[model samples]
Target: MIEKYEDLNESYVTAGAGKDSTSIFYWGGYGTDQTGITNYDKVDGSDIRGYLKPESGSYNGTPNLSANITAWTNGALSDWNGKANSNVLKGVTTGDGPYTSYATIGHVLNTFLASADAKGYDDWYIPSCAQLALIFMNLTSVNNALSAIGGQQLSPSKAYWVSSEFDSNNGHRVYFKDGSVNGSSKGSRYSVRFIRDI
Candidate 1:
């Protein structure tokens, strides 16, 4: 798991994603900048689990970290801020599908976490590969917590992307179908699942 900022390396040249070319958040200067790279990692006491709401209801207060969560999948909404229709991928009811073709895999997951309003909190962000692994390791507990929502898979039918890459041509992905992990091409359209840190 991305245990700390150092996991990103002193000067990470982003792993190749695909021919499309996507932006990655990095903390270094280009060759002639003359200044050392700046650290971009930030840590605060804010926890995402605090905002995860238990169910849909009249949400009128700030997030409560200690609030009991009833389900995780219930956060899906239609037309986030009315900018589009169907907020969650699985819940999309409009044209094409839940997402437009332009939506990058990373962006979809990030949006899910960022738009979370559970228990009145909205501080969720996408989980890294390591984080997803942690949840996988605690499969029993995680599954139990998410069981209230039927769609969560203890075993995914296909491999899912993690926003982490191994090289210019390879990226890491996890398969819930049988709890297997592997790497594949970035251009390949694979399933994606988003997670947030507790």
Candidate 2:
């Protein structure tokens, strides 16, 4: 039977299709708000911070190696203040986004990555611009599969950070709105989403 996950933050499916059978991926709230100051709800006592891909099946699309680059960077603006800007935070829709400072954003990112210690794996990454694109490309297929299983769709409009650094800059971010990359200031507060190998 299809599976579903319900939490204080959001609800989504936990499975998908594989090369020859069906698979499911449950949403792990890696990078959850711990302090409760960000106006976002905390689902579990331990902030969830990473995604866990279920076993692959026949419907699961094959992985693409070409877009999986290790290093990418987004450009920065002079106005960066290490705080999340309203335009980037997806969880909160008001006040230039959800962070009070850049440090908070970093804490959130680190929290998610660190809380994942219980999972016993450490290849988790913030994802590069190209990698984010791969997600966008596969979003439809994934979405379709999720729909069949009663999963919700996740579409965040903010620019998310990736481990990839830009050739011209020290950091990079992927603007999901247009599938573009930029060299951003490390101090600037942007959104973060984690990825791990299945």
Candidate 3:
């Protein structure tokens, strides 16, 4: 059965709660009020900082190696607001449309949206280059939690797409294998994963 966001409990909500069936991988806590406070330790839900990565199956589907970023707006090059980028690429429509037959940003965005909908949430979006770097920084802990839950761990051998665009013809991607960040042709296909704010 599909797991709903509400089904997650405190264990999953708190930052660095631990690895268990009920615990979700917490990246870190950031103060939502822009208080410039970032707590790497466990924090309660009241804190404005926290990011939750769903199970691998929930976001990472078959690698759409053919997916390109140039098929849609390149204006989503923000280093932080991936949701906005996704929204712009998806247009104002409620479902998939206007995407080319070949895998593209629109296709990937729609795929993520469908997964989010299945989880009874609608805020999931592609991670920006900065967000992807954050994930890389905490790869060990994230992988541990994923392993504990029988979820697929991030592969070091592959590069993953980010929402940041290098230009109209190129976009940024993170190489997990070596933690290298670079911009490549928008036509290049790479792995994708979605993240949501807590």
Per-residue error for 66 in candidate 2, Å, reads 11
lDDT of candidate 3 over 1-198, digit per residue (tens): 111231132212231123222221111111111122111111111321122222231223222111222221222222566666656544422111322223444344454455533366777676776567667656777777767776667776767777665544455676776555555555555666667888
Model 3 residue runs over 4 Å out of place are: 1-78, 92-101, 115-117
Q: Give residue 82's lDDT in candidate 1 (0 to 100).
A: 14
Q: Which stretches of candidate 1 lie over 4 Å from their true place?
A: 1-102, 113-122, 149-151
Highest TM-score, which number? 3
Encode model 1's per-residue lDDT on 1-198: one tens digit a residue. Answer: 111221122111122132122322211111211111111111012321122122223222334322221222122110011111112212321112222323344344333334321223343333434444444445555666556553344443555554443333444454544444444444455544444334
Off by over 4 Å in 2: 1-100, 104-109, 116-120, 144-152, 167-170
Q: In lDDT terms, how accurate is model 1?
A: 0.32
Candidate 2 differs from the real structure by a C-alpha RMSD in angstroms, to one decimal, of: 15.7
Q: Show the lowest summed lDDT stretch of 10 residues, model 2.
A: 8-17
Ranking by lDDT: 3, 2, 1
Q: What lDDT would each prediction earn against the true structure?
A: 0.32, 0.34, 0.45
TM-scores, all models, native as reference? 0.41, 0.41, 0.54
Clashing pairs in model 1, backbone N/Cα/C closer than 3 A: 1-130, 16-168, 51-118, 53-118, 53-119, 54-70, 79-86, 155-176, 156-176, 156-177
